[model samples]
Target: TKVADEKTCIQFSIRRPKLPSSETHPEEGVYKRLDVAAWLHHLNELGQVEEEYKLRKAIFFGGIDVSIRGEVWPFLLRYYSHESTSQEREALRAQKRKEYAEIQQKRLSMTPEEHRAFWRNVQFTVDKDVVRTDRSNQFFRGEDNPNVESMRRILLNYAVYNPAIGYSQGMSDLVAPILAEVLDESDTFWCFVGLMQNTIFVSSPRDEDMEKQLLYLRELLRLTHPRFYQHLVSLGEDGLQMLFCHRWLLLCFKREFPEAEALRIWEACWAHYQTDYFHLFICVAIVAIYGDDVIEQQLATDQMLLHFGNLAMHMNGELVLRKARSLLHQFRLLPRIPCSLHDLCKTCGTGMWDSGYIPAVECTGHHPGWESCPYGGTVEAPSPRPPREGKKGPKVPRDGFGFRR
Candidate 1:
């Protein structure tokens, strides 16, 4: 099948779900800066809720105010413990800063030959990606923007700190949002470490990890959006492999939404209140919401790629989160969830178990979401390039999507 180009994909209209507001559910509003502080104060005064971070986690699930995300994210990313006091947190920050500096010093102390080899092997890619990542955002808009250089430095230092994973394509995309929030290079580096440690999507993920996530996404689609699942199945092996969704999952929908909206979605996923793999439910929500075009047009693999690829900022982040939350709630309520679904839920963190289902809880970038800058220009949502031919249908290059391993 011939692949559609940007002009063609832009002409294809897709449905957008109704955007929900705080008025829709009185309790569904984001947790503000003061509210975050109060939550911590109450924790200290009351001395541990029965479930430890249960109340805090629930509040985070609703969403966090952009004003306080810098404060709250460390907890969500596991950089700071929920139980730590102000003094303890301060002390830990000092320690982490020292450790980060030591790593930097070690990098500086590398022999000239060692430094040259490192640049050729890792720093080159980091430099290339940092420049292109989120250039549209004012924070990273200028060529001389120190934040850009900071991103390069953090990723490079990370490569030194963890030689095993070294670096990969999506690492910069993951780091940019954290750096924007944390603001400090050293702290951003550590929070990023915490993030990479917690999430399966970043670094050089093992093929097994990728396969497991793809399987879960497929099974969840089957359980929740069976019709869409069947439509994809009809498209053949590419559909079944869900290579398109890999980009969605790998970058955590950063490329799929605008900068501000994408950050909102990210913190909610990091909350992991009901499930660590909430991002998977997000993938399901997107397909369920956006798949009508693919199915109705009978878009073959290439066309489907063009259709979804063009859906970046055009998508309503709130609507996607709402649908994703509803899908998660419904899945939790199911009387008999398949073991595959249950196991999938358990893969990353605590999720609803087979033990009587929890009744309910409500909640819910830039380049904003790109590693290699899918936009390819200043446009908010640029059309994606046509897929490259390979032995296994259309495939993005390893560096482009970062799933080589």
Candidate 2:
């Protein structure tokens, strides 16, 4: 008989369970891991009394079993909300598949000129990252591996899918782990889309979003660790940039930690039950873990960057998460929270304070009472007065629906 083809080999490799049979075997009784039965129970009870919180806490404290990540990730990413019934989730999946197909078809029909630029960028940028991303792992190892090709296809598809954001460095890192768990290319693509919209908002070429996140990070550090924040600031302007952390925030530490640990951190961050910016607290946790070293050693900006680089691939995910929770608890105990941080949390719809604290009020921009509101109120509601003659209003960017033009 003739040997199996490359595509067949790739499909076989991807379809294989990420976890060995022994690990998933119930007879062995791995109590810590979330199993299929438990997942189904949570699925059935989603949007019920405290079900979302309980499920999130389970995943946060103990990650979804390797066997179940593919099923669990979609829920965590909000591709299917907890409120959706089984039938509703199925319908949503169908709708998403149709949307993805349209996007793929659009990519295929792009003119030669349009394809040329993307192809060249893919060749030099994305392809290079694909080869190096998780190469040591068996999933992507070996020459002409189908998994590698799948990654390339997904990235290329994403480039066309969201031209405004386009393909950027480190995206391959973000998508590789997702693909490792989610075998179906289309499912992986949509999961990735959800991930980008929800957590990875800083990938666009526009700098405003990233700048805002950095501002939040800076404020978080100052509020949480004043001495270290001041020490870093005293180093110089470059010190304040926190350049070492850009990857952590943008990619959610995907490159910084081992694959398994990164996935655990991701699930915890996706919970968003605590705060939309919990990831920032995670950053604080990592910093607190190493802050003593930096302060004691009197490391300057460059030295601190070197110190952080060394910590990559060595930090403990669970320990950091625990520390992050502590930091959040401390933040809550503060008598007064900064308005900027409060506004940031409000913008993301995350509850920053305890239930007793005044809930964030939506500013209509027209409300006279908004001035008294501590939550940075912007007058977005139209001015009561009409525009003066010959004066033009601010132009809103036309929504291209992810098309480049």
Candidate 3:
């Protein structure tokens, strides 16, 4: 069995497919999956595509198929990059396995007195969430299901792996889908790491990181939908708290959308071809989609919370994706973006707001940082900038649900 598994991993490495060409863009309004042939082609040309930006473009336009998600998500998450050769990738797989095992061993070896309170908190928090992570989904449902045990092991191990951000409430929600798809414990662990690395602000110890994200989300609203921003502001600082939108940003809307649809939304956000903050744009799209209802109904803060909370398990993922794209197009056409916002874009390394438009070259192969993609292209490091000082808003509780105090 060991030999067979190694052979399978090697085959996956060598026969990795190339991303579909731009000419193969899915028909308008169609959601195309990355098929077998396309996957094989991408693997064959992994080295060449790494030299360019084709893979990112392909994913941006067409998400990976559910069948290939286990294979494709690793690359998307930067577990593997375009530049890795078949041999190098196999080696990486082996090394990653050993590293993950070591992390698990360390957790076992620790004396209870060494990290008692911290480990207990992590274990208790994770245990509480695991049973409820996605109980409605068959994958995690049932008493004493093996899959549920797998989820528990991975989350506990993750807490040990990254102690800095140990076991936040929504982390289980974020990891559940990856575990459902990847199935393998180690691969899922690494993929979850990749995801956290991309959205680390969501789980940072400092409230300032989350605060910055919320501030940016608000600014984005003010820019793209001034009326909505004004309406929220008119409600006072508590209203501007945007507690409802926090989980959408924090968990990438994983809790709000159904299991399958949440995966689709994540693939789009992970593509990062449109904007680094495309997920934020998706939030704006959601608000825009239901904007009329809020306006006409004159929703107070409590009422707004009720409305958004109810939207969970009820959103149209495709519609929200389409509207996000439309909003991006509209944002690009603005005459001038504020320098502060541009600085924010640079800090996020989205490059979307750099010129108030996505560069045409992003679809082409010549976009900036193509060379550095493998080393650090997944999420661009924010450039150094002066500290931003804005009128401080009221602090909201950090609970996963968005409800102001």
Tell me, by TM-score, which candidate is best.
1
* lDDT of model 2, residue 157: 85
The lDDT per prediction is 0.69, 0.67, 0.66
How well is each residue in 244-263 modelled by candidate 1, as lDDT tens digits? 77788778888899877777
Rank order (by lDDT, best first): 1, 2, 3
Give me candidate 1's TM-score against the actual structure.
Answer: 0.78
> Candidate 1: minimum summed lDDT over ten consecutive residues — where?
396-405
Stretch of 10 with least lDDT, candidate 3: 396-405
Task: Kindly report the root-mean-square deviation of model 1 from the true structure over all alpha carbons.
Answer: 14.0
lDDT of 2 by residue, 1-405 (tens): 112345332110101112233212121222356677777776544332137776775665566888978878888877777777767777877888898888888878889997887788664688788998889989899999999998988888898888777788888888888899988788889988888888743353355777777777777777667777878789888888888787787777877788788877887688775577778888987887666667765676866776677778777776676667656645544434444566555644434444545422233233355556445533232223221222232222112101110
Candidates 1 and 2 compared: the better one by TM-score is: 1
Worst 10 residues of 2 by lDDT: 396-405
- TM value for model 2: 0.76
Which rank order by TM-score, best down to worst?
Answer: 1, 2, 3
